[model samples]
Target chain A: MISALRTLLLCALAIAMLYAMRESMPGYGDITAPIAVRGAVGERVETQDFAFGAASVHLARAVKVESFGRVKDYSTSGVWLIIEGAAVAKTETMTLMSAEWQAGNGVRYALSQRFSTVSGYLPTERLEPGLPRPVLLAFELPETAVDKGTLLVARSLVMPLAEELSIALGDRKPTEIKPSVTISRSAGGAPWTLAAR
Target chain B: MSEKRTFWTCLVALIVVLPLAFVVRAWESLRESQWLAIHKVDIVAEDGAPQAFAGGQWKLLDMRRLPRSDDARIILAEFEASPTDPAILSQGACRVRLVDGKGRRFEPVALAEPAVRKMYPEVADRPRCGALAFTDAKGGAAVRMAESFIVPAEARDLSLRIEFPGASEETLVFRWTRS
Candidate 1:
């Protein structure tokens, strides 16, 4: 009898945890997602025209996100659209920055070299005309003297085909790598391209 | 008969008590997922601790916002302080306002007390510049001020800028992009 009661108690606790975890799951919200980019170009090239009247790459409203242990379900938000990027060819070596992540387990772990560049919609004023505003392109290098553009390496994060998804507290375990980002050439914003540095 | 009675009694308690416990737990979690709990945050550094800056704002360079679910506070608005700066902050003299994708700025469309209270209860009409220096040149102790704004139920794109007093010859700009 005691064992059965304990089992019932344990089951109740598990369900409560699952439900609570789902309610408070932390996600990086509102990114025009499922953005696709091509890395074949050996040199810096702009893709403004794809299958759509759109530019070089594309971004769907769909977001591609992953958690610490696994990928979560697609967020209720619209898929992020239009992802723009510059290819570094195969030979360019990329440098990565390191950071720490706090997990739900109350343990801190190092997420080293999460990626080489920044992720988000770039600000206008850095791109050429006919280029999208703040294209969803990541850098292959850092702020160093490297001829024309800043230094960035050739690396890409894969957007996992999420079969199942869930959410959790980010304070305990923030995201380390985002497989993709959203971008666009014109939403009536300024162009975001590299300045002559 | 006694054994059967005890069995039923325990069974009834299990069915009734377990769900009640669950209700209480779910109530707590619901509260947690709602709006942020902190009503007003005033960070100030005293003595030798690292002090923070007051009423500051930061904008990212490359990030696109397509309106979706409201989950995270994408931009850490009005909370700008560098490790090289102080750790603590002061927001006694200042307030903040945010301009998001929506036309609403400081006050919402209705200007209702509850609505205004949510976004700009502590923010000043304008981000005023104060002569008070929070951090010293060496990055030691300092004072600062600001009103932290909590995100409401609305789901939309957000582009924000904070205005504060100028402290140097060049324009003070706060920019950051996270990968």
Candidate 2:
């Protein structure tokens, strides 16, 4: 009985050590995720977007959203980041999926609840297989998170076991990143091209 | 004796660990649930009852309408020290009035002795219905004032104008339309 109890304790300790080591690893969330692809602020990537090869995504441009309306100015204790682009379906009709803003410190912030008009309706927009639909994603983030947060676009808000794309928000400065449009996919597949707006 | 010792050891361990785990979970829940509870209570009370959000030198904490058969809407407004600027939440001379979109003004109704005695008999006779109750605490002072008005059905845009001593008058507007 004593030997068996000692063996059980040793096994439990071994499992705990492995869990701690896994937690300490760098890029832990990305490494364990099913798929994680990264692209620059301007560089566009042609990949399976948000799922197990659901649709092909070509991100056109991303800019910081300051205001919701022309006259009405909305101010919060935190900063607002907006990414505008287009998504085209590869095989079937596509509905916009949820995305999260993952900060450098591994804090993920959901879409702001206070600003419903922008965050609520963006994901419900539909995209045809051939035509590219415009996508606007807005996230309200703390000032600390604006410096080094990556935009992770996925199908479900809490998406699991699916390949995810990490789009870096800021290039030069923390609060502001210039919007750029440069398309260069190494795979070189002509699936869809977003029309100039 | 050995078996009894082992049983007692395990029981003591369970007793200590269970309450420790519960305390940790309760602390975590209180951190998130406290703010959610305050906002939820505010929204629910305002939906069924006559409600108003007073924005001025002091922040409005709570407001409720006392149901009376006389058809007059008696609004009880509770004000607290504004987190942004607590200095403005002071005891001073003040005047509060309600104005309609067409510039019709309505003054506050004085508290009736018979109504106070009937409903809130436990309340001190010194307290009035539409009078400001100023109390000082460790952090700052809090001021609560109630007002009564007869709002007609056709009143479009209504606002509460509060004027404090040596301070500019602030207007809290209420939208009559759905949007």
- Candidate with top TM-score is 2
List, residue by residue over B18-129, the lDDT tens digit for candidate 1. Answer: 9999878787666665474433333322212333233332222232222212432222233323323222223232223444444334311112234334554553232222
Encode model 1's per-residue lDDT on A130-175: one tens digit a residue. Answer: 1122333322211121112111111222223211111121122112
Candidate 2 accuracy as TM-score: 0.34
Q: Write the per-residue lDDT of candidate 2 for residues A1-197, one digit (tens) a residue.
A: 99999999999999999999988876855555646677655555445642211122222233222233232344555555655565554333346466778899999987545434432134665543333444555566676776677777665545556656677755533333324322211222232122222
Task: Provide the lowest-lDDT 10-residue window in model 1 chain B.
Answer: B60-69
Write the residue-wise lDDT of candidate 2 on B1-179 in tens digits: 69999999999999999999997879766767657443322111211233322323344443334444332333343333322233343334456655556665555545533444466444324332121343333343333444444333344454555554433233333322221
Locate the minimum summed-lDDT window of 10 residues in model 2 chain B.
Answer: B40-49
Per-candidate Cα lDDT values, in order, are 0.31, 0.48
| Residue B105, model 1: Cα distance from true site in angstroms | 6.1
TM-score per prediction, in order, is: 0.26, 0.34
